[model samples]
Target: MEGVMALMRPMPVSPKQGVTSPRTSVRRSTPCISTDFSKRNGCLIRAQQLDSTEASTTVPPPVSDSKDNALQLKEWEVGKLQEKVAASQGITIRRRPPTGPPQHYVGPFEFRIQSEGNTPRNILEEIIWHKDVELAQWKERKPLVSLKKALDVAPPTRDFIGALRAAQQRTGLPGLIAEVKKASPSRGVLREDFNPVEIAKAYEKGGAACLSVLTDEKFFQGSYENLAAIRDAGIKCPLLCKEFIVEAWQLFYARTKGADAVLLIASVLTDLDIKYMTKICKILGLAALVEVHTEREMDRVLGIEGIQLVGINNRDLETFTVDISNTRNLLDARRTKIIREKGIIVVGESGLFTPADIAYVQDAGVEAVLVGESLIKQPDPAEGIAKLFGKDISI
Candidate 1:
């Protein structure tokens, strides 16, 4: 059908090559569209194929007018550009993989939404795809280059790592990195009457060493404004910007918004990305909490450069499965030795609900713990912190 063919035409190569700027008209070979009818001695002749040589050699026509072609071509170019960015950072997972035959049926409209007739296979994969689309829109509003000027006026970074070590020594317990979360995709809304700044103040009064503020607005019902509000409210505990960062630009943006540190998930980032981004964080004076869910992820991060704070997540972000033992398992004797020798501060994350849970991870070698659900749901979050540690940890 013409509709189907129009939607699935082979796209032009990138305009960066100077064949034609995306704003200008694209020149392409037009295919012959005809149907043949002939009477040969009272017998009708069948329609013949178009010139086989031309079909083989000729490039297809522009899918539409200059505007439509430019828009479509720009989308393709952006995908390729992101691919190059990821590849340069040693990442193999592409935002959108190439689909269909190389020279034909090059459009990915159907494949993107209906791959194998299924939605994204896992939550992490689904989140990454969503982030790709979201990042495109965000870049249109606040391009990365524009954020550099904002970075210059950003608030000074705090000693996130040093605070945790000091708290651990002072309390003789794992330092609490209290979370200010409204909701999560796994457990839905944890608190309907959530006030982020109020919760942050409670956590601080309850003796939290640091605060992890969820800045993702979609799945977590959180916002960067919360981080700013907490900072302005004079909560002295250093704030960690908890966001799904897919590019280096977000680090500078987080600093501008009053983050003392930023979380980096090892499962989502390649080793090279961690290394490169860690350098960027150091340059910006923002501490990076490199998070891992398994031994493989842990091992990969340990090999990276300038990784000071490592958080072992007990919940698998992909399947949403919780196993508090994950922290203990990954922190085996060998890994523990390496982590200690390297001066890497391990922060146990997720599924920690009680004093026993706190004690479990502490014995497993975590100097700090990032906890949310159990503490946030209590009638008084400050009391919840006391319950979490079985004593007051506030200074």
Candidate 2:
């Protein structure tokens, strides 16, 4: 033991013997995984002894989750992940916040999928994606034709189209577009008294330049009865048939339903579709409001010929994120040269609250707005229009 300590003292290799050989010294300093490392999941490694005079010390083993180590490990568990779960018991684990379903989106992008050991992603996402694609393929169908024809020949005096435009010009900013909804997808019931004629009268009194009547019965819970009611009610304001225009049958149906206008979503339709629909709208004496969300959609809307009204929607139809700035961004894209030449009517749609929001979009280049929530929430919807416009232009 004395000779061992003496040897280790000169160039210490072992604590007990202190035998100093170059090979042993080199081997001693090399990193070694604790024989008991895996026993406790890489914890409880006690340093035994060291010869003080040794030039080098043993390198600590790199932390790992490989089967080469003693601890039980999964193939997927590696890197920083191995550090997530501790070696000791009675200790809580901290996890990186989950990559859960998306909250809001700005544009189209593929979603991230997570699964255990890569078994396979659930079919639910695939199903939804397929449905989205199916909806995209519905481009072949056009619903604005016969409906336009019916509207053009509608008995309620086709000459009254000028009056509606005149009223919009007469009214100031955020010019009124009153809603005639029997029910909505959200609240279900809109007007319990639901008289289209009476409601039209009230809206007219309320100073509305146009009326939006939900005609989609499946979700919105509206009916053509309301459209006929308003049409026969002799309410002067032009009517926008709020229908899911998936098929051309809907447009013709809209004419029979007594609508003076229809919505054409740019996301759902290509430029050719918009041109065809807008042309149908003109032929049928209906005004078309080409609605867009993203810059791509705005560009698509602009490509359509004979487009007079372009609606920039804050509420996204797919994910339903309502960003008010969406309207301004789209409106700002319009060059002064194009706007003056086309004389485009820009309508800001949805998610408007205060007069400030109204004024914001109007200043952003919108001549009129299609407001629903703010006006509907009011005690007197007619008076709501007055509050929005800041003046009474009720006829």
Candidate 3:
């Protein structure tokens, strides 16, 4: 009993947080299946390994009838598969902590020790981990069935892509998707007296083709209430729910809240996830604004079918670094030809400020720009839009 109890005790804390103690060492026999607990002091902590053949071949039993042991094993297997697939595609941002899943019983003893893999490597990873917990609570409170019913009386979908196209033709410059953001993790409080409806209205009056409302409450200090308010306030511009979407359920949730479009970050999602989410977006009548930060991500997104609008984000979500040149770099000669042929409306997102900045991305071949920090910080976001374009684009 004492031997079993020792295995359950918390690992010794290191002086520096997130740094593993010298006394502890975690060894993986395979990338996803096995963890070597080895010997801790005099205690012979048994290593746990999942059979690769069983993990690959076993069909997960239905959750409704599955035992707790079956469910835990299934979840652990799924997590491993996700990690393996994401790594192959150059995605470093894990969907969950690399600590595998909670192992209720390892061999005969109950094992519940916290592992070093539980620590998030970066800010993006941290946010994603929190989101996993947040979504579980949200799902329990408001399931997909309730959200579908809400959509029955929900506001009619708006033409997000059409609006961008029309705005570009009207202004003879990159169409604007002005953002309604209160604060960002990197920039802190952008607007002291933030009013979503007012800011949205100002953007519409300022000739913004669309409005991107940050819905991430923890990191960006935004909410669905802000999105709903903007729509209910009769803002004419099509609304985009700027969210870190990890699940398809968020599509229904965003649609019910009056989102005409949603943002999908390629850095955090696999190509299969993008395809599946894009299909769901089509069903919900919400445009998917697939965002990419790297050349590999851009290439991955381009290969996906039915992607109408692609946003090149200049800010790296993992590092929160801003560089406008990222926009120009991704839209080089070869990719430019492919994008033109496919008729994809490219939107330059993040780091865009002045008219010169606008011209730089335009010269690189973007038809639209999603600017938030530059416009939302202004005395009037409407005027900020005019200043950004260096001319009045208002209708």
Instruction: Point to the candidate with the largest lDDT.
Output: 3
Worst 10 residues of 1 by lDDT: 36-45
Cα error of candidate 2 at position 144, Å? 12
Please, what is the TM-score per model?
0.76, 0.59, 0.81
In model 3, residue pairs whose N, Cα or C atoms come closer than 3 Å (at least 3 residues apart or on different chains), thus clashing, are none
| Model 3: residues with Cα > 4 Å off, grouped in runs | 1-66, 100-116
Write candidate 1's Cα lDDT for 315-354 as tens digits. 9887899999999999999999989889999999999998
Looking at model 2, the pairs that clash are 8-12, 142-248, 143-248, 147-251, 147-252, 148-284
Model 3, span 215-276: residue lDDT tens: 99988999999999999998888999998899877888999999999999999999988988
**Cα RMSD for predicted model 3:** 11.9
* Candidate 1: residue pairs that collide: 207-394
Candidate number with the higher lDDT (2 or 3) = 3
Predicted candidate 2: what Cα RMSD to the true structure?
24.5
Tell me the tens digit of each residue's lDDT in model 2 across 140-225.
Answer: 34333334455455654233234446766776555656777666544567556566677667777887778878765544567778
